[model samples]
Target: MSPTRHGWITTPLTAGLIRGALDLERTERGLLPHRLPARARAQCADPQLHMAESQPSGVRLVFRSRATAVELDTLATKRVYVGAPPRPDGVYDLLVDGRPAGRACVTGGATLTIDMATGTVEHRPGPVATVRFTGLPAEAKDVEIWLPHNETTELVALRTDAPVEPVPDQGRTVWLHHGSSISHGSDAASPTTTWPALAASLGGVELINLGLGGSALLDPFTARALRDTPADLISVKLGINLVNTDLMRLRAFGPAVHGFLDTVREGHPGTPLLVVSPILCPIHEDTPGPSAPDLGALSAGRLRFRAAGDPAERAYGKLTLGVIREELARIVRERAAEDPHLYHLDGRDLYGEADFAELPLPDDLHPDAAAHRRIGERFAALAFAPGGPFANGSG
Candidate 1:
């Protein structure tokens, strides 16, 4: 046990105790975990990228403790689109000895309100919210407090009746993955339940998720973030965001993919790298995108997305899931000839047509909680099984 803070043992929030976050900012109130570094954040002025990266998807506070009670102080910021129904507050999950022990939510904090139709933004401030968990086994065991994957939370403090010790590395492979919002834990049950998080558990690896929502547009900054981070295995799940934003055509995309890969190779030239294509989204499977929210559904307190592109635009070099997959597979094939450690994975294999019928993407763009589990299981079987690309370390 350590010195008491207000009658309870306390621990300083430090980088070593936080996992799955590339950077941590010492904010005025507390420490804030960020998936991207300061340099990468400085390169982008977009509010969306800032919000997504700040929402700690796979980030968690892990330690070894025997305390029967634990508490965390946080200042969480939630988003509220003026017209659309509000999303649920982010959930905090506690795992004891690698199994779930408790779950809770912060009651009060700040809010960011946006009027999308008018392009107006509003911020409302609030007080710190404390998430508490009691009734533990009262024996020494590892505890992992997974942050709310959908909320921007600043860690204020952590307190327990017993001292918290640093968790020794398990020598597991560290898997660093980057992708769109689906990879960002959208619509998933909670932080640890995100597909990538689940996949990491089943595959027995440490996770550093860079799955920024609506911001994975093959930006050089994001590629540079991936390049610099240390990892034992790496994968880039691309194409969805490019098509979702209707950002570019075939000509621009091909070179962008090559450039992103080239940047990552500069940091770890021989590390095994996997390129993943978009999963099956019926609306974007054949049609082009710039998917728009179903405003009518939103008026009914529902959230859904519809492709806003012209199907005929495919002939004009517009991109779709099918086209992206073809090009990604081709690119990996060509690159693998010279870079033996490079590989490709079809997202369809992760969530294919059959799986869709069984559990469809409720938002038409993001997978639901159950689908997240299914995809995680499938990914573990594919990538962690014998002879898989990431079976080796990132080195």
Candidate 2:
């Protein structure tokens, strides 16, 4: 254990768990130890041994799925168990030392129960069903879980085997982020594969992912979510969704962003907030509100296609990434004078020019998994580092 972080601590309080929701199985090793429980000494060798030290502020896993499976392989030294009633719709990943030890599987339509009192997984498979694992290692690391498709799941709680006390954070730093589906992580491999999650991993900071899928309309609710959440660092990726959805008029777009940011400022005051405009999207490059859609393809199956906007629409009520980018730059510049902590990151900095040269979006809307990795790396380089580039003020 590094002195830089505290020993594993268990909480009398068990944060509620999320069940049956679609979640992907993946391993994330870079979580800050603040709220995580320290790995147990007894069960350190099991590859399936996974633990979440900090109980209250546990990790959240979001994924798309229909039926899910999670597995944790345990060693002889430790036993994983259930702490609370399993979410009726979902199953608990066998947990050791407050972390994911193994996987659980559940189907829709029936209730799955974990008898916390008896330490067992019980199920009545019906229109739906669930499976759970128990008796796992306390110091486990590797974990595998299955989740349903096309839905989101946030893992809010876990229990651990090691015993310790909570430690208050001594540093004054915050992290904030914003984005579209890619940032929201649409169809990118797994829950951990989301760019925001990846960036949060490398940066080592609290992540408030405001990456809404097809919903980053600079909406007040979106901004309010950011404003209401505590943050030391902030970033916003705007535009593509706006173009894709044709949600607002150009006249209303710029000021709405300004207003959304203004509201966030009211809550954060001194926090550093970065506003990111869209990366290039050839489909919406010159396009306007009426983005071309393939209704015929839609009628045929799940296949859909799009084309660029009319130049005339760009002249009128159209929304283009280029146009929005120009406005966002101007807004940030004007606001920076009033707020010294404010920063502006060209979305292209995360993925522009050469990036587009290598990985063009297949549908001309969303980036592929490889692109998500590239963007995550670029973001880590430009925004997050040891000295705390994204750490608000003084590192």
Candidate 3:
């Protein structure tokens, strides 16, 4: 039962309604969403992973309520790179019974400024803000408040004119997907619109997104997390992060892929697991990277990225998208012989030259909102359509 105070009922925020997060941390402020479990987080001190896990990319509060008024309090921590353009306010998408209802944004959140060139950081404190929606229908119905995909948010409180409760499970297939920033909804309009979220909606499945911005570097802990998570379908989009971060060489990439899959198969031996190569990233397609910001664009008040590594380095075994794709395809083919449930999807097939000519990645990296929709629709048709690997009962 919800606690009532002066006609208003307060609901405790818990995992019941929160989607897309693997785990939640209770804090003095309220709850902090984490894509990785506590054990996984404790094993890695990488700042990229820390920031990515806390951003609440596909996390949302979903429930059924008859409340005419609802209010949520959040303490958000937003990022600011010294030379880049100011990011727009984070958006919260509200949906009623699977349809759009309203949208809101929290202001006055703390800011974390980074000097990318110097690797320095500064913190500016702000205050918690409230987002309220009034005039909701007084009839009990399903409601979802999707948190911002780009900002790290801490839920503080939830109050409503009528009590709210978790919506009972509807027996949807659960899809657990992991990838890089693009999959994390980097430039997607909102949480529900992220590619994985979009695909899940189109495929009629529950989503547990593990798309950790710049941290999808085949970490053992992440594989362990995937190993233990419950899911009816699984996918891992690899390559770009590994190349852009220049984290490993061609020699180590193959083994890492094998090890990651081996770990996941330990828990999900016959689960339909899809291995996706990197999408079309022209700059890093042939050239190796440790991608750097496009200072030219930055100077003109825009932010863009450019591959900074020499193309010649490929001869030395430095990884590139081209090489990664070839290797991933080979790896999948060899393993699929023994693991019939395993499958491979060329990322280029989802977004290749033809699509790039039409949609063009604005930042030379992440796709914009429109492209995300396109990819999501394509993925659903390819992966969930009849006879597809992820089709109902395929496993």
Question: Against the hidden reference, what TM-scores do the models get?
Answer: 0.96, 0.64, 0.97
lDDT (Cα atoms) of all candidates against the true structure: 0.91, 0.52, 0.91
Candidate 2 residue lDDT tens string, 1-395: 11211332222211112211112233231111111112221323322112211111113432221112222221111112244212222233333322344544344432334332343555443331324444544332333232321132223222233332332344634565666666766546544456765676567654545455555667565566567666677788888878877778789997898898998898898776777778767667676644444555444433334854576877777787788888888988998888887777778877776888898775557787799888887787777764434743424
- State the displacement of the C-alpha of residue 72, model 1, in Å, after optimal TM-score superposition: 0.3
At residue 91, candidate 1 shows an lDDT of 98
Candidate 3 lDDT tens digits, 205-259: 8888899999999999999999999888999999999988999999999999999
lDDT of 2: 0.52
Q: For residues 1-395, what per-residue lDDT tens digits would candidate 1 score against the true structure?
A: 45676679878999878998989999898899999999999998999999999999999999998889998999999989876877888999999988999999877799999776576888899899899999999999999999999999999998999888989987868899999999999999999899999999888888999999999899999999989988778999999998899999998999999999999999979888989899999999989999888887777777788999998999999999999999999999999999999999999999999999999988799999999999888888888787888775522
